[model samples]
Target: MPTVDPTVLERPVKLHHLTFLDEGEEMTVGRPDIDAYVHLPRDGAELLKRLADGDTPEQAAAWYAEAYGETVDMSDFLETLEELEFLADDDTEVTTAEPVRWQRLGAALFSRWGLAAVTLIVVAAGIVLTQRPDLIPHYSHAFYTPSLIVVMLTLFLGQFPFLFLHEGAHALAGRKLGLKSRLRVSRRFYFIVFETSMDGLVSVPRGKRYVPILAGVISDLTATALLIIVAASTGGLIAGVSMALALGTAMRILWQCYFFLRTDLYYLTVTVLGCKNLHATSRDLLLRRLRRLFGRPVGEPISATETDRRAARWYSWLLLLGYAVMIFSLGYVVVPSLVFVVGEVVDRIIEQAPLPLLLDSVVVAVLIVGQFVVAGLLGLRERRLNRTVSSQPKAGSR
Candidate 1:
């Protein structure tokens, strides 16, 4: 086996809530995206089933495993039982130790830096909204006319700035848990984010998972709020800028809810379900779909196939919706946009187009590509660090 890192869970990864089952003995929380979970041992599974089957976890581990499987370690079983509050005579109160000095400092740095960054964004946006008031709904224009595309593009591109803030929220949440963070870049490449690392967030308690999940939305919310404040402060809706900004922020929040695209919200949903790798669950669903399409029997591991069926069902639906969105965004928006820019660039390179146009087009591409490239590099580095530490062996390992 390849070496792995000891601090695998200590890297900076986003955490979210996934569905949790509090079986009197077996409690498994799945994170579908990561495709794993903290599962109560099989020995405990019998008791869990019994509890659900009208028994209690206070039953001896012997009996529980007798009904389930022999996978449970007795001590861990008892501890988990205590965690679910099934062991009345014993309970592990949420064990929270004081954070280390470095942790406190990191927490401070994270909060301070995050706030500063957000403030900068708000001020810049305010200035733009104020200056480009004319971009807002004009005093006399008609419905969905010429400015719609420009405004939509502006809003679309503008939302990218908040992407980091989303990741920052995840980083900050990890920091609060006394973990060091490995922040990754935020950009989309070919409808896929080849680089985005949330490798270090696992060590934190499940209860603390919401911060990373909600961070970007928090940033978007904060930004929108600030924009609203500035717009209000300056009097009424200046131009269409306020409306556009408002709509953009609203859409940002809505995007998270869509769940069709695996945005931060998707991660959060998987976290809540305790499904570690939603990608895996999704793959499983896709496989079943493929089988069905081929007119094959679902058979055997059919029960396993049905595992997390509720969440799984949503996965298929969201996936369908997601691909539709992808086709529209990619073909209609991204491809056309890229083609236009590239055509203009090629023309300039061959001296068929003006240098000024070429220079501007190249600048936009560089700016966008540069952001993703940097983020991807950071993500790769995080994974490498984790793999390095996790490869170490235990003293008793064979």
Candidate 2:
């Protein structure tokens, strides 16, 4: 491995292509090539810009001392940049190729004409729903089949496509702006969900990020609207399937309202509030308060921007409310449903029901149990990974 020179700061530094954005009182400076960003005070950002403009560390530090009435530790700043992989060995400019697979499709979807078409569809769907209130989504729509197994199977399997479309919309929106994104399975509490990771968005201007952040919810609404229209226009099984899809899509749309779970809307909220990590900061604040109440060590104070600290003061309450909501949902919805299903299964077995009936009940039980098993396994895996990573030595650690 090439070792960094001890007196490197005395000479000019080479930097990768960096993007800067003024975010409220802070500035977001990032190396898009590595998708690494940091929120810095205006002075820090200016110092970095000066360094990137070929000023030696001594020159930048002198300027900082004169302008900010304090000196900057160039060694510490260089270490931070090294951690972010922002330092380049050569002066050659580097250009990364745009991700091409979905670029064109993404562009087309967000185009002016495409947006107009979507507006028309949404408006037409709204008119249809208003005229035919019967077509609106209901929980009952999920039970499109008489067989418990069939209903479970339809709902469980049928939702994947719509879920893909929802997450795909988010990915495409980011892709439209030449941002690379990855879709992965992640857990939000007990729910296993698909998420689009678009780290590059932090480097993008705030005004342009809303569409990418909201694309999933918009897709869900659009899917629900289209499904409602299809349900209204069709009959029999087709109508039933459409209604089931509409119900599923509608539920997903509503799921965004649980911002405490760090849902899409939570990202929107943080972005709008100009917070770097509100959810995490709020969680830490809540934990500290609880620890104090229990007479336990409260540990160190959370390090966060003033905006985040201010928002966390109230957001912490919302975080507690979120826990309460989860508990209430488990009690009112999950527990009751589990009891009812188990009771039915027990009764069916005792009565020596037909083979198909017995099999349906068994399959439904397995599906429900399997989902919980998968969630538990994923949680365990995540915890193990966290432990492993924490045990490893950090970069430049002695």
Per-candidate RMSD, Å: 11.4, 3.1
Q: Per-residue alpha-carbon lDDT of model 1 for 1-398, expressed as tens digits? A: 32323342123212232334453334554433332345544444434454434333334445645655554444444344333333332233322223423555436634758667766766766666586664333333222235444544555565566666555665565656654455544333333232245543554456666765666677676766565555555754353455566566666677666565567787788778866556556656777787889999754322322345666777766776777786787688766766675676666778855766666667766555554457577667767877987786321101
Candidate 2's TM-score reads 0.91
lDDT of 2 by residue, 268-312 (tens): 999899888898899999999999999999898666888899999
- Model 1 compared with the native: what TM-score? 0.52
Q: Candidate 2 regions off by >4 Å?
A: 1-5, 89-100, 335-353, 393-398
Q: Which pairs of residues collide in model 2?
A: none
